[model samples]
Target chain A: MMSARICDKIATAIAWLAAIVILGVLASFLLYMLYKGLPVLSWHFITGMPSDIRAGGGVGPELFNSFYILVLSMLFSFPVALGAGIYLAEYAGTGRVTELIRLSTESLATVPSIVLGLFGMIVFINYLGLGISILSGALTLTLLNIPVLVRVTEESFRAVPSYYREASLALGATKWQTIWRVVLPNALPGLITGITLTAGRAMGETAILIFTAGTTVSRQAGDFDLFAAGETLAVHLWYVMGIGLVPDRMEIANGIGALLIITILIFNLAFTIPGRMLQKRMTGTRQ
Target chain B: MSATIIDHHRLKLMYDRYVRYLLFACAFLMTFIILSIVIFVGQQGLVTFTEVSPGDFFFNAKWDPSEGQFGAMSFIAGSLLATLLAVGFGAPLGLTGAVFMAKIAPPWLREIMRPATDLYVAIPSVVYGFIGLTIMVPFIRNYLHGNTGFGLLATSIILAVMILPTIISISEDAIRAVPGSLEEASLALGATRWQTVRRVLLPAAMPGILTAIVLAMARAVGETMAVQMVIGNTPQLAKSLFMPTSTLTSEIVIEMGNTPFGSAWGNSLFLMALVLLLISLLMIVAIRRLGRGSVV
Candidate 1:
């Protein structure tokens, strides 16, 4: 009996130790990145453009490209993703079509970003002859974002009580009217959260962009040419560290990393804060 | 009054039918986009499958894109080898962490750890790649010299860290789903906490645990940025984990540009995509089955 108790104690201790180590690794990785990266971060580093010999370069163009690609992709993906989500949650009958949709969405989610990159290369770059352009990259990212948004939006829609829909219908509102006036407003927060998360994923994405969004850092920011190739912050980070950029490349990479972290943090806050507050308000009112 | 009521009813019926059609169209559009991508990839990849032959692509070691002699065997092997190594090292640690979070940790600790996992997932793959390149590569270079910095070991370690979030989150869900009643029953039989977890709860949650591991494997295998950054991008199969190697995805990235349009190179990219698609399909199936089975 005493031996068994000792064994139990040993196992518990091991479990705790494992948890601590795993968490420690995660925390340490973040801290080390910031530590090695922060010293190089500066205002000039954020706002400046690239110079010769890898010495005096900044990521101004890269930042613009990242934002541009993100906006374009979101613009393309949002309506389709939301439409599909609504169909699945509110309208689809139990049949082959629904099953196929579900299976495809799941498969789409799992198809590695690299494969998407490959597909983009073949269809967008080769077949359509779009070349390596931001349009092609944005289209590929739209494909990537749709599956995630669909799933999240579907979940949010389902979470809404059925009575709300019924109440809207009972008031002589048409089905579309009910959805627009009642269901959509209630699900908007979750939908926004989902969209923001997808945007974050798209922003951090590197593989798909490698093929479609050419690696050239634009010299100017205001160019609205979709056909022109461009690089984003993430890709810039990869190129700088991978292939030796200017002299201040390490600092530039750190600044980019810091920015990437901040962007994602904003995304997470966008997702969770409004969500929790709305839930709290609803529950409080119920009580 | 009767005529007005009849007209309203007719409009309602027509609107319902139209809405149903709209829903069908939207669903069809989603399916069309996914299927079109698959078809496009397969159509383009057919040239490689036909020209290169299965034996050469799967069994040959060399990946000479310049000569149109493309064999992805080494890359495939490297990806699988790295993924296996990652799972070997990461699975136990992740499972233990999950168990601790779900069963052992106090409420406050659980709350903190939960968000930490979220933050881990939210960090972009490129950032992970950057960190690995800056920190892990130098660390490995310092210790192991020529064979260390860029190899399967570095790639595997980075992948292990990258997939940690998946394993922890999924396995935690699995462990938490294990019934308290089962624990009570084991304790009633004089089983200690450890015994209950090891013998009863673990067994019951085996499928969930397996799902978590499989999902982690899927993520590890599919990971590109971090692995690409760390792995030396060498196209060869090596006996030692310390030796440099390339993966299928990394190969696609490296060779996609050099491959001529509508040639075997393009087809090879498609072939790689097909492999990835099949693996992901298997994972989704496994996860769905496990999820359904564990609903109790």
Candidate 2:
């Protein structure tokens, strides 16, 4: 009994230690990556041309492709995911079809991103003859984004108070009208936050883009050619580290890492915080 | 005015009916996509057996593909070992962190840690690999005296960190779901906080924690860029933890670009991906079973 008591104290200390260690690791990792990469970052680095065998090159096209692919993928996925989410939240009944949809969603969510990349390679790149281009990459990324968006949409819609729907229905508004007008507006903050987080994630994604997007950027910065090879920043980072022959690949990798971290921080600051504030105000939750 | 209002109402009804079908189609698309992926990848992957025997593909260790060796046992072993090692290290720590958040942390601390975990998740897997390559690889080489310091140990460490958020968040939810009455009853019976947690709370939450661990394992197994970067990308089976090796993901990423789309080599890569897909799907099914078990 006395030993059990001692064990309790030890376990408590161990739990606290685990928390501190995890926090410490995160802090040190961010700080260390920033410290190493900060010197490499500049307007030139952000917007300059990448060198093949040279020392100083910029990631201009890769940066452009990252955001371009993100936007393209989101545009492709949002409507379908929104519709699915609406169906699940508003229209799904407790039946086999709903169960199957849910099971499919969960299964899709568990499918490896790399496998999705392969499927993209086979279908979009080869069978469809899209080649390894921005279009193919965005299409592949759309598959990756769908499950998450659907889940987020469903969750966000479910979070809307029941009374909103009840009140809209009571006013003789049609189901579609009520959903479009009231529930969606109320769910906007959560949806925005979810979308922003997804964008942040997609921006940093590398594996799916690697096979689908190809590794070479177009010579021109901000090239909007759908068939052009689209190497995003994350892929560039991986490429520079792996098989790159450039003299300053290390410095390039460092800069991209720092840039990605900064983008994530801005996402949290710019969208997530504001969205949370809106949610709190609308929900009337002070705590 | 009354005629226009009636016309508008009729139009709205028609629109509403049409939208329902659209939403249903969208929802059905999930099933369609999943089916397409399995069929496409599976069809491409199944071609390997026409030339190579399943016994060789599954059981053989040698995987040259140039001289026509199709053995993928080493890659499979590497993936499983790396995943198991990662779960071994990560699960306890993650569960502890979950317990800390759900039980011990002050509200202010919990607030900070929650976002911190989110940030951890947001950090790209490649970045984790980069850090492992730049920092961890060298440290292991010098201190542990490994040849390249790129192998199972390094891969496992990075993977453990990568999966921490999944384990922590899910397990935390599970811990929180354990009824408050159970805790109070244990406390009222002269049990300490730790005793109550260990004897009552953890048992009740075991199924959830198990789900979290399996999910973490699934993620660890499928992880590509990170494992590829750190695991040395060599196809040979490692004799020790420090020896260089490769997993299915690393091998596919390394060789996929070079192989012709319909060639035996490319087909083999597709087959490896199929194996990974099957493994993850199996884990999901296992989680579903566990979830059902928890209800009883």
Instruction: Write model 1 residue lDDT over B89-186, tens digit each, in one string.
Output: 88988888888888899988887787677777778888888888877888888976745688888888888887777788888887778888888899
Runs with alpha carbons beyond 4 Å of true place in candidate 1: A166-176, A283-287, B1-13, B144-146, B289-296
Error of 1 at B287 (Å): 3.2
Candidate 1, A282: how far from true, in Å? 2.3
Candidate 2 - CAPRI tier? medium
Clashes, model 1 = 3
- What is the per-residue lDDT of model 2 for residues A117-232, given as tens digits with 9 covering 90 to 100? 99999999889999999999999999989988998899899999899999999999999999999999999989998899888888889989899999999998889999999999
Model 1 sits at an interface RMSD, in angstroms, of 3.2
Question: Residue B230 in candidate 1 has what lDDT?
Answer: 84
Lowest summed-lDDT stretch of 10 residues in model 1 chain A?
Answer: A278-287
Task: Output the number of the TM-score-best candidate.
Answer: 2
lDDT of 1 by residue, A1-287 (tens): 99999999999999999878888987887777677767766767677776647586777777888889999999988877788889989987788778888877877877888888888877888789998988998998888888888888787788778999999999888888888789988887667666676687788888889889978855675467898887888888877777664777777778788888878777766567676567446534310
Measured by DockQ, the strongest candidate is 2
Clashing pairs in 1: A54-A246, A54-A247, A55-A247
